[model samples]
Target: MSVQIRNLQSEDVLTYSLPLLLGDVRPPLAESKISVCNRRNNTSMSWPVYNGTFKALVELKPGENIIELMFYGEVVELVLVYKVPPLTRFVRPVYIKCHDDPHGDFQGPEDEDCSAESACQRIALGAKLIQTLTAEKLAEHGFGRKTFLLETDLDAKAPACHVFTSSLSVACAQQMTGAELWLKFACELMSAKTFTQKENCKWFCFMSFTRYEAENDSLPKSHIDVLKQTKGYAALGGGGLALFSTGNLHCWAETLDQVPLRFTDTRKIDRSKFMDDSAYRGFYWANYSTGLGSSLHELGHTFDLAHTRTGIMARGFDDLYRVFIVRPLRSRASSCSRDSSRLTTPSPYSSRSRSRVASGNSIGAEPCFLRPLPTRLHSQPSFPDVIHIEVGFAQLPTKLTQCYTVHHYDGSETQTVVTRQSDGTETRSQLTLSPDGEWERKDVKINQLDAGKTGMQVTACRELPMAPSALPHSAVDGPDSVQEFVLQGQTPSDAGAHWHRSSAVILNYHKWFNEDCEKNQGSSPEITGGYITSPCGLRLIELRNHDNGTVVHHWEFLHDDPPTEFKVNLDKVKDVLPADCVECSVMVEDSRGNISKKKVHFDDL
Candidate 1:
């Protein structure tokens, strides 16, 4: 007869229980043997027949999981398929005003001094300008398309404004203000309700305009702080971007906080006489056009982009001109690419000099009104290296070994063993790495008959020295060392000796066994019991005596954490045993995977 699968069917879940039975044959089901294999990943599990049935929990990968079942050397196959869930994206817009005037209302072109037809158009133009220059570059660089959308709240006329009553310079703001404070202020002012909500909306673009003197400009520090805070917050759920506008270069002081400023006169100059120094140079000085360029650069930083040598993220007007002016003209032989042409021809700015300044251009008949400027190149960005260490346990019959694996981006790795000396000093020994990039040590021993626990530790580094003087004086700044406890004991002091010869053997143990042991008895560290926790739970096995003490009945139990007082009934196994059975043995396993056994005779019944 062939192997028989009793409870499982096709189309099972990624994680489910599987039950199997030996052929449709004899009275003793103990002879039935089965082996399970995950054909897709080449992983397998085996189980010995227990009583009249066999069962195990199986987990499959996302795609097709081909499971092979072998019973009595006969093979059968089953397939299970799982699918990944779809991703949802959302973009939120936050308008912020950092100015000295609290009652100043946001005005548009339709308003007396305003030039834009509507506030939405003004904000939308900024967003479009940003997308025009960055969308293509980000895609070509393999960072994937932009996943954010900018939607304006038109009915809400004025943007949320944060007033600063005191005189604060850019340097002072950097020293006093933090990103967390800015986000808190923005969230409160904007009435941002969904930040902590369950929805997928997380990315927020914060556009801020300030009326303070450009010399005292300190918004850069705030921008950096906001990005740092938002990135950290994103690790949990939400992230944000801060875009600051300082109005136009004309409103700025000649020198801000002792730094010199340079300006170029663009009035009535012939188109053919245009030179490289035709634009202004001041810290954080940008008219509408340059403001958009600077805003795009800040937005790039929020996207994990580094400053390039010559793109929008590059320093100074020369780089911005290359990105916003020269690059587009060179790419298109005739008319500017639709985006660049939109800026020069129809003009998104209003029909006024201030409006032109806001757009980073001067009023002129010459197309591409912005001219290149002289500026120095900035230093390239730098990144630090990191290493990760992982610890695990490999269990066998007699002993348990602690395994350590150190991973680094660079190929090189080193291992070190630390030992405490008799004179209260510590000594270190370097170990050679195995072919598989792992190091294992069997320092903790298991009696297999007693419940006990022990601790182990290992240190890993990028390099080791042949002489003591070569070692770093301070280990804190050097390689990493990890320490954890290893449990090798059983619970319920009399677990093995409690089994009685009855219809059913009921075993009761503490549910909060490990937690209570750690907190009250100081047996080990406080650990939340789970599949990965050492000495996770207890296991029980039953064996019935057959011909010459050959085992006939086998049963086992494995759990993360048992109840405070739990009982296991074995009536099913008792009914399957033969009347001639003379004796039986029961084994109790502890959370540390240690097993202890007890035997009882039929006469004891």
Candidate 2:
């Protein structure tokens, strides 16, 4: 492919032409097709050519005019820069790392071996903890995605190390408040001496204070003023602004309250004296210096997280020294049992923020609530349409011997729930009523509900047996109050599993069985039950029903892959179950990619 360039003058259109070549054409067509491209904004235009070359006309405006030749064919793309911007610019993510240090502050002497292995492990653990916390917070809060680098640079002169925010904004804030110095203090204290440090070296630094007057300037009031902006500048305090990063500091037990401790004779002191020191000079590294939490506390502050009263990084005094030594708590040997298990099978740990809280169970307590998983009913691509029905009475009656009927959405008689005694069985005994002020509330269940049903009416009546030793007259009427509910669901199928499609599910109500046996000579009463002719076999998965209530005639269907080939009558096979139930659910599984579920409300039963 090749490109061509052309120049045009005012009042004239110059046609820039380029050749469109593809494959191995011997003397290709005179004018071929090509595309024109604008390098400035990465836009392009394409056109077909009949000959070896294609042309685009350009009318130049003013100033320094530039034109470029470009080619785009089946074979390749070609571009020639004919214009350029005066200045080019680009931006990239910033990374901070240890720069140059003229003095070997961090480097060890030729034979120096201060337990490097343990120190490195602690450092690595600290870094990983920081990264983990930051990642978790970012995920929960939806923060912008950007990589942050944690670089460690050791200071040789002062034995001081700090976690500096490379961002200028952070640096400026530090300079204005001396926060960086405090941060260094906190981190050094937190990185207490390891076993190796305690066994081998006397790691120490020197601190000095100087009073300087800035000509006619105010004197520094305290050492904190250098790190913090205060009313006056009286003095500048300096020295080894450092703390033991690996082990405990050795100080006289008698003067644990001293600000800056100095060993009169370093060789005369022993480990016991160091272990008993409770001295802390400054608000060094926030929680890190205090040793109240792991590295997470310090890391939280680095991420701009503030102290909270009840969080993982809650602001609490770092009484580690007092907790460990002054109190002289028992020291148990560390165990690998818990650590090994954790390392092998890690599980998610939950930590709450300021406002969120977690609840736990104590003695004589139960869970607030329970949530069961939702069951599937249909395997079809879509959900089954739902139709609900309710049965109720307009008013209450003096006596309770009336029946209420349930109605479907289509205004048809769906089911009947009665409050009466039949066959020497007192169904009214199962009915409950609650009195609210002057009104009586009675809620009952109706079973075996259908899609379409007519409205039901309750009539008042009086039954009595008056004799020398018989019952007295009694009036019958509707209950004081009533309410009902119903549920309906269906499944879709494909044709071809069974030559004659037939599906059936048995309904058994233990309460009805016992009631009928005791009242009717052990003969079970016939309830509504049947099957629909489906093209293929159907599967019944689960059954749902309320306790102590009549069962509703609602069910779930299992869908087969490619839909089972069958024609089934869902209504003909439906049946009402025994028992007074508010709601029942069923889950069905078919030879398909999904599961089917159905839930029916028995309030209308």
Tell me each candidate's TM-score: 0.28, 0.17
**What's the number of clashes in each of the models?**
19, 70
For residue 297, model 1's alpha carbon misses the true position, in angstroms, by 3.1
Off by over 4 Å in 1: 1-87, 98-120, 142-147, 151-181, 186-191, 194-209, 214-238, 249-286, 305-605
What lDDT would each prediction earn against the true structure? 0.32, 0.24
lDDT of 1 by residue, 271-361 (tens): 1111111133322222333444555555544432333322343433223322221111121223322232222333122334434443334
Highest-lDDT candidate: 1
**Residue 41 error, candidate 2, Å:** 44
Q: Model 2 misses residue 536 by how many Å?
A: 61
Evaluated at residue 240, the lDDT of candidate 2 is 15
- What are the per-residue Cα lDDT tens digits for candidate 2 across 1-605? 44433222222221111111122212445434445444444444443333343333221222223334444444333332221112111111111111231111111112122122323323333332233233222222222111122221111121112222222232232233234433443344335452112221111221111111222343222322221322111111112121122222111111111101111111121111111111222211211223223233443333222232222333222322211111111224422122222222211111121111112111111111222334566754885677876779576433336555432222233233345333322232222221222323344543223212422211000000000111111121112111111111111111110000001111111111011222322222111122111222222222334342112222223222212222222332233333344455443322211233345443322
Residue 227 deviation, candidate 2, in Å?
18
Q: How does candidate 2 fare on TM-score?
A: 0.17
Worst 10-residue lDDT window for candidate 1 reads 460-469
- Give RMSD to native, each candidate: 29.0, 36.3
